[model samples]
Target chain A: AQSVTQPDIHITVSEGASLELRCNYSYGATPYLFWYVQSPGQGLQLLLKYFSGDTLVQGIKGFEAEFKRSQSSFNLRKPSVHWSDAAEYFCAVGARLEGSQGNLIFGKGTKLSVKP
Target chain B: SQTIHQWPATLVQPVGSPLSLECTVEGTSNPNLYWYRQAAGRGLQLLFYSVGIGQISSEVPQNLSASRPQDRQFILSSKKLLLSDSGFYLCAWSSRVHEQYFGPGTRLTVT
Candidate 1:
C-alpha cells in the first residue's frame, strides 16, 4: 500500500536557524509528493509539490522541498526559521482512485516549535 | 483561480444529534471533491470523495456519509454524531492534476 511517513513527531528550532522536516514515502510507481502546513484551528495550506521534471520545488513562505527518488523522500527545508513558522507540517503522496481521480495519503505530521 | 469554502466554521452538538457540513467550490467546473477529517494530534484522513454528481466513493467505513448533489457542492452527514467525530473537517477540490486546494475547514465538536 502507498503511504507517507513523517519520522519526527515534534521538532524544536531556534529563531533564525535552518530547519528541515524529513518525510519518506512508500509507493509502487513514480509518486507525487506534497508538503502542507497547518496552523492551530485552521485549514492546511499547500507548501510545495513535486510532479515531474524538477527535483527541487520552491513553494510559498520561503519554503522549498527536494524530491529524492532514490531515497523515496521529499523533505521540506527553510533557510531561516521564523517565530511565526511554528506549526504542524504534513507530508502526503498522491494515489489513484477510481478512473482518473486521485486522493492523498498523508503522514501523521510533524509539529515544529520555534524558540525565540 | 479556484477556491473552496466550508461552512459552519465551528459546530458543537450532542452525541445523538444529526450532523451536516457543507462545502462548495468556485471558479472550477466538473472538479473532484473530497472530505477529510483531522483528528487531534493526527494527520488528515480521507473520508470520502466524489468524481461527479451523485458519484461518491468512500475511503473508510465509519459513521459518516458524503454526497455530491452538484458539481461543485459536497456534503458530509451523519445520522448521529459520535464523540470520536470531534475534530476538524476539511474539504478540498482538485482537477485532473493530482494537486488539491483546501478550504478554511470546519471544526466539529461532538459532546
Candidate 2:
C-alpha cells in the first residue's frame, strides 16, 4: 500500500536556526510529492511540490524540499526558522498518472515549534 | 488562478444532528474535488472525492456522504453527526497536474 511517513511528531528549533523535517514514502511508481503547512485552526497551505525534473523544489515561505528517489524521501528544509513558522507540516504522495483523480496519501504530520 | 472556498468557517453542533458542509471552486471547471478531515494531532484523512458532476468516490467507510450536484460544487453530508466527527474539515480542488489547493477549512465541534 502507498503511504507517507513523517517520523517526527514534533520538533523544536530556536529562531534563526536551520531546520530540516524528514519524510519517507512507500510508493509503487514515480510519485508526486507535496509538502503543506497548516496553522492552528486554519486550512493547509501548499509549501512545495515535486512532480518531475528537478530533485530540489522551492516553495513558499522560504521552504524547500528535495526529492530523493533512492531513499524514498522528500525532506523539507529552511535556512533559518521564523517564529511564525511554528505550524504543522505534512508530506503527501499521489499517483503520477495523467488524468488521475487527486487521491493523495498523507503522513501523520510533524509539528514545528519555534523557540525565542 | 483557481480558488477553493469552504464555508461556515466554524460549526458547533450537537451529536445526532444532521450536518452539511459546502465547498465551491472558482476559476476552474470540472476539477477534481476532495474532502478531508484533520483530527487533533493527526494528519488529514481523505474522506471523499469527485471528478465531475454526480461522480463521487468514497475513500473511507463512515457516517459521511458526499455529493457533486454541479461541476464546481461539492457537499459533505451526514444524516447524523458523531462525536468522532469533530475536527477540521478541509475542501480541496485539483487539476490534471494533481497538486491540490485547499480552502480555509471548517472547524466542527460536536457537543
Candidate 3:
C-alpha cells in the first residue's frame, strides 16, 4: 500500500523565520507528489505538485517543494514565514490503482503556528 | 473556467438525524467526483469517489453513502449521523490527468 507520513504533528516558528515541513512516502514506483494547505473551516488548497521532470516545483502562495527519489521524500519550504501562512499542511501521493482513477493518500497533517 | 461547489458550509444535527450534502461542478464533463472527510485537525480520509454517473467506489465502510446522478453532481448522505461524524467534508473534481480541484468544504456537526 502507498502511504504518506509527516513526522511533525505541530511546529511553531516566527513570522520572519524560514520554514520546512517534512514528508516521506512509501511507494514502489516514481509516484506523483503534492502539497496541500488547509485553514480553519476551509477546504484543502493545492500548494504544489511534482509529476515528472524538475525535482524542484514551485506553487501558489510562495511555496516550493523538492522531490527526492532517493530519499523518497518531498518537502515543502518557504524562505520566510508569514502570519497568513499559519495552517495545517498535508503532503499527498497519487498512484494508479484498480477500480479507481487514482487515489491520493495523505499524511497526518502538520499544524504550523506562526508567531509575530 | 472550471469550478466546484459544496453546500451548507456549516451544519449542526442530532445524532439520529438524516444527512444530505450536495456538490456540483461546472465547465467539465465525464469528470471524476470524490468525497472526503477530515476529523478535527486530521488529514483527509477518502470516503467515496465516482468515475462517472452511477459508478461509486467506497474506500472505507462508514455511515456515509454517495451518489452521482449527473455528470457533474455528487451527493453524500447518511440515514443517521453520529457524533463521531462531526468533521469537515470536502468535494473534489478532476479530469483524467488526476489533478483534483477541491471546493470550499462543508463543516458537518452531528450532535
Candidate 4:
C-alpha cells in the first residue's frame, strides 16, 4: 500500500538556523508529493508540490523541497528559521481514485519549534 | 482563485446526537470535494470524497456519511455521534490536479 512517513515527531531549531524536515514515501507509481503547514487551530496551508519535472521545487514562505526518487524521499528545507515558522508540517502522497481526482495520504506530521 | 468554506467553526454535542457539517467552495466549478477528520494528536483521515454532484465515495467505514448535493457543496453527517467522533473536521477541494485547497475547518466535540 502507498503511504507517507514523517520520521520526526518534533524538531526544535534556533532562530536563523537552517532547518530540514525529513519525509519518505512508498508508492507503486511515480508519486505526486506535497508539503503543508498548519498553525494551532488553523487550517493547513500548502507549501509545495512535486508532480513531474525538476527535482527541486520552491514553495511559499521561503520553503523548498527536493524530490529524490531514488531515496523515495521529499524533504523540506529552509535556509533560515523564523519564530513564526513554528508549526506542524505534513507530507502527503496523492493516489488516484478510480482514475479520477486523487486523494492525499498524509504522514503523521512533524512539529517544528523555533526558539528565539 | 478558488476558496473553500466550512461552517460552524466549533461544535459541541451530546452523544447519540446527529451531526451536520457543511462545506462549500467558491470561485470554482465542477471541483472535487473531500471530507477529512483529525483526531487529537493524529494525522488527517479521509472520510469521504466526491467527484461530482451526488457522487460520493467513502474511504472508511464509520458512523459518518457525506453528500454532494451541488457542484461545490459537500456535507458530512452522522445519525448518532460517538465520543470517538470528537475531532477536527476539514473540507477541501481540488481540480484535476492533485493539489487541494483546504477550508478553515470545523472542530467537533462530542460529549
Candidate 5:
C-alpha cells in the first residue's frame, strides 16, 4: 500500500529563521505529492503540490517544495519562518485508480513551534 | 473559484444518538467529494468518497455512513454515535486533476 511519512513529530525554530519539513512517500509509480498546513481548530490549507514539472514547486504563504523522485521525498521549505507560520504540516500522496484519481493518504504531520 | 462548506462547526452528542453532518460545494460540477476523519494526534483518514450523484464508496467500516443527494451536496450520518466516533470530521472536494480543497471541518465529541 502507498503511504506517506513525516519523520519529525515536532520542531522548534526561531522566528525569521529558515524552516524545512521532511516528507517521504512509498508509491509504485510517479506520485502526486502535496503539502498542507493546519492551524489550531482550523481546516487544512494547501501549501504546494507537485504533479509533473520542475522539481521545485511554489505555493501560497511563501512556501515551496522540491520533489526528489530518487529519494522518494518531497520536502517543504520556507526561507524565513513567521510566528503565524507555526502550525501542523501534513504531507500527502494522491492515489490514482483505474484511470481515475482517488483519495489521498496523509502523513501523521509535524508540529512547528516558532520562538521569538 | 470553488468553495466547500461544512455546517455545525462543532457538535456534542451522547452515545447512541444519531448524527447528520452536511457538506456542500459551490461553483463546480461533477467534482469528486470525500469525507475524512482526523483523530487527535493522528493523520486524516478517508471514510468515504463519491464520484457522482448517488455514487458512494466507503473506505472503512465504521459506525458512519455517507450520501450524495445532489451533485455538490454530501452528507455523513450515523444511526448511533459511539464514543469512538468522536473526532474531527472533514469534507473535501477535488476535480479530475486531483487537487483537493478542504472545508473548515466539524468537530464531533461523543460523551
Candidate 6:
C-alpha cells in the first residue's frame, strides 16, 4: 500500500543545533521521494529526491529537503548540527504499482546524535 | 560512471552452510539489479530484483535465490544455509528515477 513513515526513532542534537527529521507518506498518486544516508559500514548514500517541481530539494552532505504535497510530507533538513553529522537516516518511496519493477519503499531509520 | 560490487566483504557460516553472494555491475546497460537486506541495524529489505538476462523478481520470501546469468552478473543463492539468514547484504543499481547506486556491503554472519 505504499508506505513510509520515519517519526524519529532516535535523535539528539547539540553541536550547533538545528535539524529536523520527519517523513511521512502513504502514496497513491504523485510520490517518488528519497533521502538516504548511512555511515557505519556505508552502503546507502543518495540524500535527495522529489520528482516533480520545486519544493526545496538539495542534498549531499549539507542536506536539505522539503516536499509538502498537502502535507503528505517529505522532511529532512540540517542547519548546523555537525559532529561529522552522525549517520543513519533513510526515507524512501517509489511507486510503479501496476507497471512494477521500480522498487523502493523504506522507512525505519533515523538515528542521529551529535553533542559536543 | 556507475559501479556496484558486493562480495564476501565479511562472512561467517556454520549452520547448514551453502550460500553464495556476488553482484557486479560496472558502467551500465539494461541495468536494474537489486538485492538488499539489512537486519542488524535494520532498514532496506528487498530480497531480489533483476530485469533482464533471466528475469527474476522477488521481494522477500525465504532462503534466498537470484540470478542474472549475464549483463553485469548478479547471483545470490542458498541451498541450505539459514540462521535467519544472517544480515547486511546489499547490492544495488539503477538507471532512472529515485536514484539507486550502492555496494560496499556484505557482512553475513550465521551460526
Candidate 3 error regions (>4 Å): A96-100
Clashes of 1: 0
Q: Name the candidate that leads on DockQ.
A: 4
Candidate 4 off by > 4 Å = A96-98
The alpha-carbon deviation from the true structure for residue A91 of candidate 4, after best TM-score superposition, in angstroms, is: 0.5
Interface RMSD for all numbered candidates = 0.9, 0.9, 1.2, 0.8, 1.0, 8.6
Stretches of candidate 5 above 4 Å error?
A: A96-98
**What TM-score, to 2 decimals, does candidate 3 have?**
0.96
Q: Write the per-residue lDDT of candidate 4 for residues A8-51, one digit (tens) a residue.
A: 99999999999999999999876889999999888999999998
Tens digits of per-residue lDDT, candidate 6, B1-111, equal 887888878999988888899989998898888898899656889899887889988876897799999988898989888788988888888865537878988998889
Instruction: Pick the winner on lDDT between candidates 1 and 5.
Output: 5
Instruction: Please list all clashing residue pairs in model 2, or write none if there are none.
Output: none
Q: What is the C-alpha lDDT profile of model 3 across A47-111, one tens digit per residue? A: 98898999999999999999999999999999999999999999998885544486688999999
Q: What DockQ does each candidate score versus the true complex, computed on alpha carbons?
A: 0.79, 0.80, 0.68, 0.81, 0.75, 0.24
lDDT of 3 at A67: 94
lDDT of 1 by residue, B1-111 (tens): 888889999999999899999999999999999999999777898999999999999989999999999999999999999899999999999898888899999999988
TM-score of each predicted structure versus truth:
0.97, 0.97, 0.96, 0.97, 0.98, 0.35
lDDT of the candidates, in the order given? 0.92, 0.93, 0.91, 0.94, 0.93, 0.86
Q: Of 3 and 6, which scores higher on lDDT?
A: 3
Q: Model 2, A1-116: lDDT tens per residue?
A: 88899999999999999999999999888799999998888888899999899999999999999999999999999999999999999999989777678788899999999999
- If you score just chain A, what TM-score does every candidate get? 0.95, 0.97, 0.95, 0.96, 0.96, 0.34
Runs with alpha carbons beyond 4 Å of true place in candidate 2:
none
Q: Which ten-residue region of model 4 chain B has the weakest summed lDDT?
A: B38-47
Counting clashing residue pairs in each candidate, in order, gives 0, 0, 0, 0, 0, 0
Candidate 5 CAPRI grade: medium
The TM-score between candidate 5 and the true structure equals 0.98
Model 2: interface root-mean-square deviation in Å: 0.9
